[model samples]
Target: MLSNKNIIVTGAASGIGAQTAKILKQQGANVIGLDRHPCTENVDQFIQVDLTDPQSIDDAVAQLENIDGLCNVAGLPPTMDRLMVMKVNLLAVKYLTENLVAKMNDGASIVNVASMAGIGWPQSVDAIKDTLENATFDNIESVCDKHDVEGPRSYFFSKEALLVWTMRERWTWRDRGIRMNCVSPGPVDTPILKDFIETLGERAEEDMKVMDRAGTAEDIAPVIAFLLSDASAWVRGINIPTDGGMSSHVMEQMHQFAK
Candidate 1:
C-alpha cells in the first residue's frame, strides 16, 4: 500500500525497527533505515545516526528530501541511564520530528513506537505535560531527575510522554494532511525484551501469564504498516494497542480490583 513512497525507519539496526523496515520494503516503500550502526535488512539506504544527538538528527535531515513517512522506532531501554533514556526515547523524538515534519509530503503519516508502559499515562499527565513543555536535550536530565524518572521508570515515562505528544500533535499538520499516531506494544520479544523482564521481574512474569505469550516484531509491524498506509486515513491522535489484548485484560482486572 505504501508503493513508491519513501519512508524513514529509525532504530533500524535491530528488533522492531528492523522488522518494520523490512515489512515496509515488502510493501514497495523505499526504506531509508537509520541507526547508530549499519542496517542489514530490507533498507534501500542506511544512515548511521546517534538518535540522542540533536546535531546528528540535523545532519541526517539535511541529507533527506520528500519523505513520505517516518517510523520513530528507535529507543533505549530502561537499562540505560535515566538521562540517556530521556534523550533517546523522548527528547530526540521531538527534535527529529519537528525537523522532518516540514520536509514530509502532504498526506504523509508518522508512526511513533510507544509501549504498554504508557497505559498508565492518565496517572502521569501533569508530569508528562511538564516534561513535554520544558524537556530539551540540554535539560532532559534535569527534567527526568526532577521527576525521579530512573531505571524502568524512565522507559515508562518516555512512552507516556511520547504517547501524549502524539495526541497533542494530532492536528499540528492538519493543513498539510499529515497524521500522527502511536502504537503501544506489550512485552515484545525483542533484543530489549530481557531488559524489560529483568526490570519488571515478577510483574513481567505475571503479565506474560496473563497474555499467554510475548509479542513478536511481526505481530506489531502490520499495525504500524496499516497506520502508515492510506487504509487508516481517517485515524489520528489515537494510540493503537498491538499488545494481544493485554491492555484490555489489565483494565478489566483493575475494574474488578477497584470494586
Candidate 2:
C-alpha cells in the first residue's frame, strides 16, 4: 500500500519502531530510519539522531528529501531521566515534525505513537493548553518546571501532552493536505517492557492479568501503517486505541456507575 513512498520511522533501532520500519519496507516504501542507536534491519537508510537535541534533529531534517509519511515510534521509557523524557518523548517529536512539514508531500500523513498512559490528559488539560499555545524549545524548560513534572510523571505527562499536541495540529497543515493522527497503545512487549513493569509495579501486573497477553510490535504496526496510508484519506485528528480492547475495558469501568 506504501509502494514508492519515502517515509521516516523514528526509534527504528529496536522495539515497535523497528517492526514498523520493516512493515513499511515490505509494503514497498523507501524507509529512512532515525535513532540514537544503530538500526540494521528494515530500512533503506539510517540517520543517527538524538531526539533530545534540537541541533541533531535539525541536522537530520536538513538531509531529508521528499517525505511522504512519518512514523514517530521512538520514545524513552519512564526509567530515563525526567528532563530527557520530556525532551525526547514530547519536545523533539514536535520539533522534528515541524521541521519536516515543508519537506513533506502535500498528501503526506504523520502518525505519532502515543500510549494508553496518556489517557490522563484530561487531568492536565489546562497546562497542556498553555504549552500548546506558548511553549517552544526556548521556553519548554520553564513549562516543565512550572508544572513540577518529574520521574514517571514526566513520561506520563509527555504522552498526555503529546496526544493533545497531535489533536491540536491535525489541521495546521491542511492547506498543504498534510494530515496528523495518533495511536495510543497499551502495555506492549518490547525491549523496554521491563521499564514499564518496574515503574507501574502492581498496576502493570493487574493490567496484564486482565488482558490475554501484552501487545507485540507486530500487533501495533499495521494500524500505524493504515493511518499513514491513503486508505485513511478521510481520517483526521483522531486518536485510535490499538490496545487489544484494554481501552474499552477501561471505559466500561469508568462508566460502570452509569449503568
Candidate 3:
C-alpha cells in the first residue's frame, strides 16, 4: 500500500517503531529510521537522533526531502526522568513535525504514537491548552510545574497533550491534502512494558488483570502502517485504539456501561 513512498519512522530502533518500519518497508516504502540507538535492519537508512535535543532533530530533518509519511513512534516511558519524558514524548514531536511538514509531499500523513493513558484528556482540557500555549523548549520546566506534570503524570500529560494537538492540527494542512492522526495503544508487550507497570503500580496490575493479554508490537504496527499509507487518506485527526479491547473495557468501567 506504500509502494515507492519515502517514509520516516522515529524510535525505529526497537518495539513498535522498529516493527512499523519493517512493515512499511515490506509494503515498498523507502524507510528512513531515526532513533537514539543504532538500527540497521528494518530501514533503508538510519539517522541517529536524540529526541530530547532540538538541534539533533533539526540536523536530522535537514537531511530529508520529499517525505511521504512520518510516524512519530519514538517515546519514553514514565520510569524515566520526568522532564526528559515530557521532552521526548511531547516537545520534540511538536518541533520535528512542525519543521518537517513543509518538506512533506502533498497528501502526506503523520501518525503519532499516543497511549491509553491519554484517554482522560477531557478531564484535562484546560491544562492541555495551557501547556500547549505556554510550554516551549525554553520554559517547559515552569509550565510543567504549573500543571503538576511531575512523576508518572509527566507521561500521561504528554500523551493527553499529544492527542489534543493532533486533533487541532487535523485541518491545518488540509489545503495540501496532508493529515495528522494518532494511535493509542494499551499496555503493550515491549521493552518499556515493565517500565509502565513499575510506574503505575497497582493500577497497572489491575489493568493487566482485565486485559486478556498485553498487546504485541505486531498488533499495533499494521494500524500505524495504514495511517501512514494512502489507504487511510480519509482517516484524519482520529485516535485509533489498537489496544486489544483494553480501551473499550476502560470506557465500560468509566461510564458504568451495562455488561
lDDT of 2: 0.91
Tens-place lDDT per residue, model 2, 150-255, is 7899899999999999988889998988999999999999999999999999998998998999999999999999998999977888999988888888788887
The parts of candidate 1 lying over 4 Å away from their true place are 257-259
For model 3, how does the per-residue alpha-carbon lDDT over 140-165 read when each residue is reduced to its tens digit? Answer: 98888898888989999999999999
Quote each prediction's TM-score: 0.97, 0.96, 0.98
| Candidate 2: residue 252 lDDT (0-100) | 84
Q: Best candidate per lDDT, number?
A: 3
Rank all candidate structures by their TM-score, best first, as comma-separated numbers.
Answer: 3, 1, 2
Task: Report lDDT per candidate.
Answer: 0.91, 0.91, 0.94
Model 2 segments beyond 4 Å from truth?
A: 257-259
- Candidate 2 clashing pairs? none
Number of the top TM-score candidate: 3
**Candidate 3, superposed: residue stretches over 4 Å from native:** none
Clash total of candidate 2: 0
What shift in Å separates residue 69 of candidate 2 from its native position after superposition? 0.4
